[model samples]
Target: MQSPIHETTELEELEEFVINFRMRRLKLGFSQTDVGSVVGKLYGKALSQPTISRFEVLNLSYYKMCYLQTLLQKWLEETEDSLKHSSDLTGFYPFTTYQPIERGRLSQRSFTRAFMHNPKPTSEEFGYLAERLGMEKKVVRIWFYNR
Candidate 1:
């Protein structure tokens, strides 16, 4: 549970909290995008679905995880309270009306080959791969980033 940059009880607790958080979120019938829509309103900083997903999986930096935990902790409390007080929780939460972004499927074969050849592809290399894979350069970049 101890990340290299942050080896502390706090990190361990956060790691545990993240696992529980995801469970509770699913139990509450909330998707990552659903949480993302309202988490910002819980505090001031709005997080995207991808960001929330990263936080849940501990893919973020220790510092970023710490910050997001504070926000999500508050959100968890509010969401629970809403569930307790209302059968229709949507009335209590200000879930956004915006549509979720369409997720792009990557070409696994090409990406795997690219990764094996160069784990950290340069900007130009990323552009080339993106063109060959028919995906946005940013998507290709994020794929590598997540890896």
Candidate 2:
């Protein structure tokens, strides 16, 4: 499946940024191999090297290009500093906006949302539901919480 890219007057501005980025790297005498290595390390995936190069063919969406632009900006800032230190400095917390119960409303989970809507099911009621689904009771409990 293909995604959509926006075409507008601002597209020219985006192209200019990509071209200028290529030129800046070339001026620094960095080969494609060098940039690929940097991208690979930045994403912690060796395959991401050629993947970044394929951005030309992919013509990545503006939002995706922005992610690359952010990485490239960091690359420029840290070109003289330690590269290892540039590894994923991000942190994630234990919270999610995704409500598993919503998905279960249609299917996948029934003991929670489906039963709750018509009749509040007891743990034993949920146990039978889980047995039919070939899942454990504890699994259903966690699904209830996450849902």
Best candidate, TM-score? 1
Per-prediction backbone clash count: 0, 0
Which candidate has the top score in lDDT? 1
lDDT of 2 by residue, 68-141 (tens): 77676666556534334552222110111112223334345455455567455578867776655534578866
lDDT of the candidates, in the order given: 0.77, 0.54
Per-candidate TM equals 0.58, 0.39
Worst 10 residues of 2 by lDDT: 91-100
Clashing pairs in 2: none
Residue 7 in model 1: lDDT:
71
Show model 1 residue runs off by greater than 4 Å: 1-6, 94-147
